[model samples]
Target: MRMILMGLGVVGRSFLRTLIEKSPELRLKYGLNPTLVAVADSSSAVQDERGLDPKEILDLKVRKGSLSGHAREVGMRGVELIRGVDAEVLIDVTPSNFKTGEPSLSYIKAALNTGKHVITASKGPFALEMPALIEMFQESGLHLLFSGTVGGGVPFVRFVRKCLIGERVLAIKGVLNGTTNYILTRMEAGLSFESALREAPGTGLR
Candidate 1:
């Protein structure tokens, strides 16, 4: 699978690192060879039709704090970048903009219209436009995956789709936000809500 990754934040960087580490295993066990052909951050974007080095991209982001330092950086971003890149899939780990469902929403629409599948971790788009997005993806005959939006790594969405085929779900209940769950845990352990909030940033919870 050829891919374009947008958003170079913590989730994006970590995803690149993990993809590099698991490349061999993915190919050997699943016959899946995922090549990152493009990457983009808020400031800049980069592309190579053959393939872009995930490590090089990750290192540039970590060292310089922006993809602008990359030699392949381009002027395009968001929807324009998505349309320009030649890739089978677009992985969007962009930050959530719940109120507007912006950038990522626009990016997803562009990718589908241009015949690219999508895998997104960003929640805002789905939260605000699930029905429309799903309809678009269906009409395009492309995959639209958002497993990371709700469960991080738990595959909760997949479980619901596969296991609950015949069953009708009346109610769903669980703690979905990790930051809020951590704060609640701390409060249960006797810390005040204010103290938990103060400690959250330092612990990288929020």
Candidate 2:
């Protein structure tokens, strides 16, 4: 599947790394070959419909700190990139902006309008405009996935939607933030709050 990935932050970089490492397994086991057609950060983007190198993209981000240095760099905003890319799916790992549902929200809308399925890790759009976004995707006959929004990769939304079935859910309780959960776990292991907070960064929780 051809895809466009937005956001080059920690989550985005880690996701690209994992995709590179697991591509072979993914193809062999699931018959899924994900090819990145474009990748964008806050300030810049790179596009290659034939397929962009995931490793090279990571290297560019690390060495230059932005995708602008790439030879295939494109001059376009996030929404424009979403609409212009000829991709089947859009993986939006952009940062959340609960106050406005940003650029991610706009990017998602453009993808849906252009008939691209969306898989987003950002939560702001869903939190603020779940009804409208859900309606948009449903009407477009495309999938709008957000499994990573609520509880990272735990599939909380999937569990609730599939496992619950007709069962009534009385209440829900859990730590949605991984960093905070890590600190709490450390505290349970007898570390002070401050010490746990200090140790969280080393574990790459955030």
Best by lDDT: 2
Q: What does the lDDT come to for candidate 1?
A: 0.88
TM-score of each: 0.90, 0.90
Clashes of 2: 0
Candidate 2, residue 20: the lDDT equals 93
User: Per-residue lDDT for 136-199 in model 2, tens only?
Assistant: 8898899999998876567888998999989999998878787788888889999999999988
Model 1, range 108-185, lDDT digits (tens) per residue?
999998999999988899889999999988887999999888754468999999999899999988887767887899
lDDT of 2: 0.90
- Candidate lDDT values, in order: 0.88, 0.90
Q: After superposition, how far is residue 74 of candidate 1 from its true place, in Å?
A: 1.3
